[model samples]
Target: MEESFMPKVSVIIPVFNVESYLAECLDSVIGQSFYDMEIICIDDCSTDNSLNILMAYAHRDSRVIILRNDCNRGLAFTRNVGLERASGDYILFVDSDDYIVKDLVGITINEIDSVDMVCFNYKKKDEIWNSGDEHIFKMKRGIYEAQEFFVDTVNNNSVVHSAWSKLYKREFLMQEDIRFITGILYEDIVFHFLCMMKAHKISCIPEQLYLYRVRNDSIMTKRVESKNITDYFRIACFIGQFYLEHSFDTRLEKAIEQYIQTVYHSFICNYRRYELANHGYILKEAIAEKRFAKIFGIVSGIENYYGRVQKKIEENIGLIKDGNSILVYGAGDIAKEVIETLNYYDVILEGVAVSDKSGNRKSLFGNKVREITEYLYKRDESLVILAVTYKFYPEIKLKLSELGFNHYLEIF
Candidate 1:
């Protein structure tokens, strides 16, 4: 490509107290083989030494621009600063704590055709910065069109409403007035949908080339309040109306229909302990108004109409005896729920077992956390509560039986 023929991309990064991983993040953005882009770092009045480090970088390279916020505005506002100051044909958001693969820019840039956004698979990293992931995807027709991208991605299990993992056209983004929601968490969820709705052509590339670092201090991973759900649901409900008014398409509608359930369920599950005074009212309104789908998520995944069946099983499990010594079958959030419900009934949990081909095995519940393979062989045992959904039942049952387990049962 000739000098001016190459499309200019403005890579925007928002930083706030990500001092520990900022260096690595900067390296990736600055090290991009495609040098036509500018790396703009917006510091959201970080109290940490993040600004100092960014300034140090600015001194070294003219391409690295550092913008300081007058005060501690939230992520939405900081990202908008990046958006407002961006000077390229396309805009890309990279989180300060996350780093891109060496080939990420080179590959994503090739996808600048008939696409609103181009996305690649991402790897999860721990606070220590170690990477973790199973399967990654690469898809096309995920590039420019918003609603098409959302529908296809959700159906194929690849859509994640995160900003750090995608590239977007500046004109499309600006035209949509799609800025991150100020002060509120879960901005990506709503914003992504809106963008997709406004997109013309879409595409995707399935490559696990981005590293997403999981930090305890990050707002998303923190224990959320009941109001968090209220806020998220409210935005999602509005977006649903936005879609309806636009009259997008069946695929996008189906995608949102299934998605609303998971969103509501997440709200309910995250705030399971404290009753959201208006949780029921908000969800009922969302559902009754035909704003969202009834989510019946199976304990593990948001898939295959399993959420409904899982809800039915959960209703019955609540009626079971609490005094029973429970050995929960799964080690996920839902399994945690079974454990919690059992504890609510004053039942003693014996152990937890997890079976997944693509995950690291670690103890979650206080019960002697072990793999089903390891836990079932123990001669002295209690109820092996199959806390997992029916989909995984065959695999779990086969594994437990192979270990000569006879007391295996379901929480319901």
Candidate 2:
């Protein structure tokens, strides 16, 4: 097909009250090098200037099509509305607040070929970041068995939770009658989970391209109404139940257990959400009936296990106390984990190396933070702990070698 005659890709964005960043989000899509596409901006009855801003953009760009929710329909219903009106070969849902990479549309479509879904990496940011590599969340990619892509997403990666992060073949979704549930808070997740399960082929690339803005108020991450919390539990159970109803893959079961471990670890013991009691009761029932015993076996006492690991890392700091200095390789969660544990164990935290991403040279946990280069020049006998995510291990190790950082170790 000629460029102008090519089927337009419908980029669906569900709008709410994101006045501050709506223009940036729209600019990225409008400026996309890909010309044969339409922007479907759904105004979900915002109480702010969001709808007006979207209208302004629509007036400026003929390709921008605007839709309105009769009332404040949830994200799922908004997306379903976009899906219903999308007259394109492919459809993609992007959050009203988040913006895509500059080459996101072109690169994804080029690499997508004829796959049912094109998955790309996304980076989370409390502030805007130009380099996508600093805060990336990676997931498994490849062809999946012909189940609804949404079905596999529940235990692995909730597709609904990430509607804006991937591209969809619109025909595949509409032909399968995949639509989001109305009057629900987490409709995207439920609908996406249902959609992906029926997908035949999926592709993933590791390029960290999507920027997810974490608003300071964190309202998006905050707890919803009591009724919404109850709805969440029902949705959670329905997701797990759907996965169990489908197949006999032991690998899938093991993966499911890991997700449960993470959930129980966060909601049950750690974050200490008031949700603990109700969920804890269900957990106890599961243990009593031995229903998800395998999950329990894998996750039981994970807290204590982490505590022991922290203890061991502190013990390793014995070297630093014995006439050796220490360098911590990461400045984020894991580095903080090790630094805090060492201080708890009475090991003095001498120097902290913020990850090379920013080449930061300031205190993150305490007044001890400095650049790795600065730390190296300041001290000779320092042993560094490669306290970073496992995925970054190889590159960080190589970076260390280039910088002559030989005296280091990893927990794994």
Candidate 3:
């Protein structure tokens, strides 16, 4: 490939310290069915052998371009660097730890006709590829006009904020000035939201083109630190501010409200995760600011949900003291309230059961937090409280049933 030669698509891969999976990731892209593309791998000062692997690939293939950062810049900056060097008409992001199907580029390029962006589905991979069963981005092939994309996505709560799952037109992104925000953990949320808001023609494909490797070290899989909570609040404030600056059509009002409601639920549910005393004050200040009116409107109703959750928790107090090992099935806000209410009646909580211990606290309410699967042998002896959101009820119920857990209290 010559300097003057331009590719049809640019695959921007921001590499950090992923040495073990780099070759597989690179191989998947290099062996893509589509040939007219450039693989831009920006090494973010990886301390491991990732750079050597990247160098080997770059030596073998002319299309595999390698760029290195002076320091260990984060994923957002590394991606922006790749964006600056990308010489393709279209763009696609790929994480160094993940890989895509052979026809990913070919199929997405075929569907990208006259559209600003093309989003496809992805399957989750751990030890083996598992059915993610996620509702996000699970949609039929269709094109959406200007605010229609955002409205539909938010209405269905199907916001796949990962940049890796989409193919974007370089011209549209540059015209809209859509770039990743630096120094943010959830940069994709802001970038994807901007694209959804500005894009005139966005297409959704039902094909599962990408393989998302679920690792314990991944940012989203790590424990919910104070920074994570603050970053989430920052994203909410940013979305609210963006809404204030741009006058969206009235048709999107309900959709935007629904989106805010979802974010608010998480914010309130993770309130106990904030470490600093001023964290509540930060939210209060955001509420006071008119720019965050959309966000804080739901924030105003935070206490209302508590009453209902508390009432539900109290109703299950009698069954808790029936001589079985008591455990809470969730570690969220409602779980905290359940524990507190149970403690009010001097009920002893044996443990807390979580889907995964990676993203949750090691201990909740002074009880050791373990995976729900760990209690399969003790299912008969444990009395569990399913304290989770309404949206997750069906999935949790099914999981409990599958694990042979019969005695459990359900909280909406």
Q: What TM-score fits each model?
A: 0.76, 0.65, 0.76
Index of the highest-lDDT prediction? 3
Worst 10 residues of 3 by lDDT: 127-136
Over 4 Å off, model 2: 1-7, 128-133, 137-161, 181-196, 223-232, 270-412
lDDT of 3 by residue, 271-291 (tens): 643335666775565456665
- Candidate 3: where is the Cα deviation over 4 Å? 127-137, 274-281, 298-408
Better of 1 and 2 by TM-score: 1
Q: Give the C-alpha miss distance for residue 230 in model 1, angstroms.
A: 2.3
TM-score of candidate 3 against the unseen true structure? 0.76
- Ten contiguous residues with the weakest lDDT in model 1: 300-309
Query: Model 2 TM-score?
Result: 0.65
Q: Candidate 2's residue-wise lDDT over 55-124, tens digit each?
A: 8988888788898989987777788889888888888788888888788888788755667778777766
How many clashes (backbone atoms < 3 Å, residues ≥3 apart in a chain or on different chains) does model 3 have?
0
